[model samples]
Target: MNDSQALGRISAVVSENDVVLFMKGTPQFPQCGFSAAIAKTLSQLGVPFTPVNVLDDHAVRQGIKDYSSWPTIPQLYVQGEFVGGCDIVHEMHQSGELAQLLRDKGLL
Candidate 1:
């Protein structure tokens, strides 16, 4: 897909899923440390999320970064909102804020 098409797809995916992870690979086979860390955190929290592997598609890999303007992989979206990457997620999980946020969204 082209850039515009990829962005459109990303938008659709984000809106359709309550929680989405735009990562480098599948959750079960994450290609990067950051991606694996976040995936593990979510799993431990029992949060059901959709994982989009950017590694399989160049346009999507680049498009997602542009869409979120975060310049990073493993971007998390909760209830259609950008929820930062690994370090931010790790901190939130440690502080109990991630669970709180999920609860607030009626996701947990």
Candidate 2:
């Protein structure tokens, strides 16, 4: 499929699921440090999410960037909204906002 098509598929995955994390690797084997950090944060918050491994598909890897308008993997989407990456998630976690947000979305 094309880039937009690939991105549309990923976006549908995110939208259909309550908590979706498009990361560089799986939850058990995060490829990047940031990906691992985000995984840990999500775990710590007890937010159950489906992880999409970008490494599994090149189109997904590049398309996700275009999908979010953010040039990064390990992107977090809550209720279909692009929530940002590790740094932003970390900041939200530290400030006790992440949990609240998840709860608000009924994902926590």
In angstroms, how far off is 85's CA in candidate 1? 0.6
- CA shift of 31, model 2, Å: 0.3
* Candidate 2 positional error at 45, Å: 1.4
- How well is each residue in 6-73 modelled by candidate 1, as lDDT tens digits? 99999999999999999988999999999999999999999999999999999999999999999998
lDDT per residue for candidate 2 within 13-34, as digits (tens), equals 9879988899988989999999
- For each candidate, what TM-score against the reference? 0.99, 0.94
Question: Of the candidates shown, which would achieve the greatest lDDT relative to the real structure?
Answer: 1
Weakest ten-residue segment in model 2 by summed lDDT: 1-10
Best candidate, TM-score: 1
Model 2 clash count equals 0
